[model samples]
Target: MSNKRRRSIFEIFEEYFENLEKWTERFREALIEKPSWDHRACTMEPLSNIMVTPTEVIVTSDLPYAEENTIHVKPVSEDTIEILAKMKRKIRLDDFGITHYKGGFQTLRCQIRIPVSVDIDKMEVRFKRGIFEIRLPRKQERDI
Candidate 1:
């Protein structure tokens, strides 16, 4: 018979707790820092969601009016990533019923903090239909 091992109950619980902690941290960040336009210094905050798995972390954002060629994703640190995207057309404050701010914005900028360390070099980014998706592979621990 082939040798196969199943994870123990304790191991499963450990994994569940780790995931819970990670999601709790993310929820805290979201609540502490509102992603509204005013909180973002007049820049529009694109709605985003993050999903973490044992192998990778997936980040997705809704970037309306942004062009694929103008999108950029960079890993700022082991647990942070910066995203910038330029809109195809300028969005003026007047468009949002705010005439006092007499200027327009053409770019969107935001930073996302990952819950776990990731391999930036292996990260993959894709933009399609005004949506941006990023997949970052989790760093493997070396047993020494």
Candidate 2:
């Protein structure tokens, strides 16, 4: 490939400003738009490549395409629960060489219904990157 002509300073500035404005709009929309909850799964399934330990039930999900910070875990009921996560990143447009960053947010909502009811107040949820670990205490059967 031979060398090409250079772009003017004004052109560069224009493109930068355009992309900047686009990102600003996205952020504003995300903030102002009323959040509509979307359930990704009716129930949470066992992770394909995660470890579950004793004393607590550990569930790790591979969410490479999601943002770790947006992950939210809530106990819907005694045994049933839910997980929600989203991922965002800056990507280049294939058609236009424009550097507008499109959000790659992903929401994985899983409803977990265990064999026994869980105490939502004592539930613990920890998230790092796309991996989420939910530690839940095992329920003991009471004398009838």
Best by lDDT: 1
> Tens-digit lDDT track for model 1 on 64-143?
98878888898787678888888888788788898765666777777799998888889899988777999999999786
lDDT, each prediction: 0.83, 0.57
Give the per-residue Cα lDDT of candidate 2 at 86. 56
Residue pairs clashing, model 1: none
Which stretch of 10 consecutive residues in model 2 shows the poorest summed lDDT? 37-46
Give the backbone clash total of model 2: 6
Provide the RMSD of all predictions against the true structure, rounded to 1 decimal.
11.0, 19.9
Worst 10 residues of 1 by lDDT: 34-43
Error of 2 at 39 (Å): 12
Model 2, global lDDT? 0.57
